[model samples]
Target: MILAALAALNVALAGPWPALAGSEDVVVEGAWARASVGTSRPGAAYMTLRNTGNEAVTLTGIMTPIAMMPEIHRSTTNDKGVSTMAPAGEITIAPGESVAMAPGGLHAMLMRLQEPMNEGESFPLTLTFSGGGKVIIEVPILKLGARGPEG
Candidate 1:
């Protein structure tokens, strides 16, 4: 009876366990967007995503009212020494880790923009987690030549 009581005490102290068993904690911070003026059909937005949840979260999609389509993208340097960008299917953020959407890395691609993205403007941005929860952020238009966060 004493052993059973001790076990019960331990379980209560630990509270309800995570549904996923052993999930780690991660968070997102310092999320912002970069402004762009381009003749192309699409423009890019940059930000940093920090994972502060108890489980790894995958960035599956984004919601933006300003653009027709918002997709995850990454920059890749080709053999010719030119940097090319493409769509990113998903991004995984480990517990206590972060994913940066900066220049020459992963970013958000806003396609079919209704209007030109100007500096000093704000837009609605919604990031969806794979598990279910979504984070809604207001992304301000940053300077076109501004550099993203370092580390």
Candidate 2:
């Protein structure tokens, strides 16, 4: 009876579980940018990252054609009830596990924007893994409210 109940509970929680990706694997899906029309000096991009490699890897740096510096950033809460985005030195993805970089969490902070980011446009992005492998991806800029399709 206990075992059966545990199985049922697992099934319920599994619905929201994250998918795993390989070590040499770098997948940038559901990439989107905020859609606040007109004024756009700086904007952020969000996506999900899965690393399925035998060895642990860290996301060390980023490169983009439009931005001067593309850095890894995470959102944190302070004691004053204020939220701030801080620069992350590196993000480690353990072997056989995955990392998700999405809105309200870890994300790529595109700073020193050279041009305005519009919806439905794709941009070139290069993510450097700690193990010396670089993944070049074409990230589609989408509206802020857009979300990845549920599997």
Q: Which candidate is the best by lDDT?
A: 1
In model 1, which runs have C-alpha deviations exceeding 4 angstroms?
Answer: 1-26, 38-40, 149-151
lDDT of 1 by residue, 26-94 (tens): 345565666667635677777778777667777778989888888898889989999987788978877
Error of 1 at 32 (Å): 3.1
How would you encode candidate 2's per-residue C-alpha lDDT over 1-151 as one tens digit per residue?
9999999997786555333322356555665565434434556777777655566667788899878877888988789978888888888877666677776678888888877777777788888766556677877777655654321
Ten residues in sequence with the least summed lDDT for candidate 2: 14-23
Superposition error at 35 for model 1 (Å):
3.0
lDDT (C-alpha, whole model) for all candidates: 0.73, 0.70
Error of 2 at 40 (Å): 5.2
